[model samples]
Target: MKRKRTISLNSSSITTRSKTRAAAAAAAAKFYLPDDCWESVFKFVINDKSKFKNRRYLNSLSLVSKQFLSITNSLNLSLTIYNGSRPFLRRLFQRFTNLTSLDLTWYDRDLNKLLCQISRFPLNLTTLTSLTCSRVDSLRSGDMCLIADCFPNLQLLDLSYCSYVSEEGILQVLRRCCKLRHLNLANCSKIELHGMNFEVPNLEVLNLSRTSVDDETLYMISQSCRGLLQLLLRSCYVTERGVNYVIENCTQLREINLRGCCKVHASFVASMLLSRPSLREIIVPSLRHFSVTEREFFKRHICLVY
Candidate 1:
């Protein structure tokens, strides 16, 4: 009777072990992410389609299975065509659909036709949130307007070092992208404020450092972009009034950079700092120390600068 009992226990233990292994295998087979999910991850990782930094990894993914290859080849990814990439832009652009962002900062001044082709993406009559394109002289105002009209969801536009982009391009972007939050026009020498009216209610950060902005344009931007929080106007022509408007009206402003803006008066800068009690720091040409009284004034009186 003892031998029979021991044998029965052993048999039950073996049965339990086998059942657990089988259940685990079944769960893995049923609950794993489908092939389509993997494709989405791949698309998000490679925002720039023209040249992926990890070519070896992408190639390995392509070899995983036919299903993956199908998705990879499908038009459901964001694309970028860097200037020196081997494949043509046409072939690269033909593969992607549902693209939400694009970075085309790798062009050699031939963007007219390419801009037209890019305008055919998922966004229609809307602006893109992030556009890092190189401006071209050949691009007419109409072409620029068309490009701006394409990305309705544009929030951050980086036209840095694009010499071809003028005031018209800036205006076009500002007019179309009402929700623009960050505008980087660094080294865009042609952006002037004369006769320019922009309404960017959601603009929080604007970097026009080293650009050709006079006092009038700077003041205009101050009035239009009331929600501005941080502004960089280094080496630009900014007077006392322009500084006053920004410091007084943009109550949420934390940092105001006037490095190389030689026209700004010291008195105006002091007042700006005092008005915005919440201002943590100001990037001036020579910022060595702050007096106790100045600090106290800022802490006490700057709660209502706007």
Candidate 2:
């Protein structure tokens, strides 16, 4: 006859055997707290602006019980994908089932494969990254469709320092991800002035800083992105005519950053003040010859001239 494993119900086992008792407690759920209640407590702990860090609190909670571990795992919605995280990608995704935003700036592996792995989960990606993606493989035009298909609700996309993101890929993104609002194409060297005729009707904030964007590109942007609120063209090749065109056409433009566009003159500030009365902020390359009225104007409006 096959022998069956038996549990020791002795006094010694009851006092000293932690594993058996812990397992029994978890299985029994004697004082089972509701998941939602635990979630609320966790949120309060995490959102506390006090001196104690939330990570330490969570680490302590995770060790309390299996239920606590599962609840903590579910609370994790954002993850930073790096080269070291590649091997444990499957396990990580399984643990953090409700992940949304992902930062891949530190990722140096195959971008396509990583994206494919991410696509398996329906994550609502909408956020930023401190570091730029210069090390990873360039996201191709074909991959844009895959990205849009997976994360169609993506509102904010930070592709800064991704120099090889072609204009066609951009067009693909605009075509598919219609809900896209904030697009960070900063330092994308391959973005040329010509053949970018697509419109961004839903786009609100655009960062084209340190790119090869010229007058024609600005003109195109002026017509296409009329609903645009903020335009960052810092260190771009845009001229006076281009800037003026944008100021005229982009009616709702609240802020414009021309801090490094050497082609734009200081005199254009006066023109901007006269033309766009609704302008809240204007980051100009240089400012001079400010009258008392102009100083008052600067005070009234938050204009930053550098």
TM-score of each model, in listed order: 0.71, 0.78
Task: Tell me the TM-score of model 2.
Answer: 0.78
Kindly report which residue stretches of model 2 are placed more than 4 angstroms away from their true locations once superposed: 1-33, 48-57, 120-137, 287-291, 301-306
Candidate number with greatest TM-score:
2
Candidate 1 regions exceeding 4 Å error are: 1-32, 35-60, 67-78, 83-94, 120-128, 134-140, 265-268, 287-306
Residue 10, candidate 2: C-alpha displacement in angstroms: 9.5
Q: Largest lDDT belongs to which candidate?
A: 2
- Whole-model lDDT, model 1: 0.69
Report how far residue 109 has shifted in candidate 1, in Å.
4.3
What tens-digit string does per-residue lDDT give for candidate 2 at 1-306?
123223434645666778788888988797677988999989986895542466567778989999899998877666677889987877887777776566777877677877787677554333211213443456777666667766776777788888677788777777777778888888887686466577778998999999988999888888888998999998898899989888998898888898889999866886786677667788886555667887776766666433
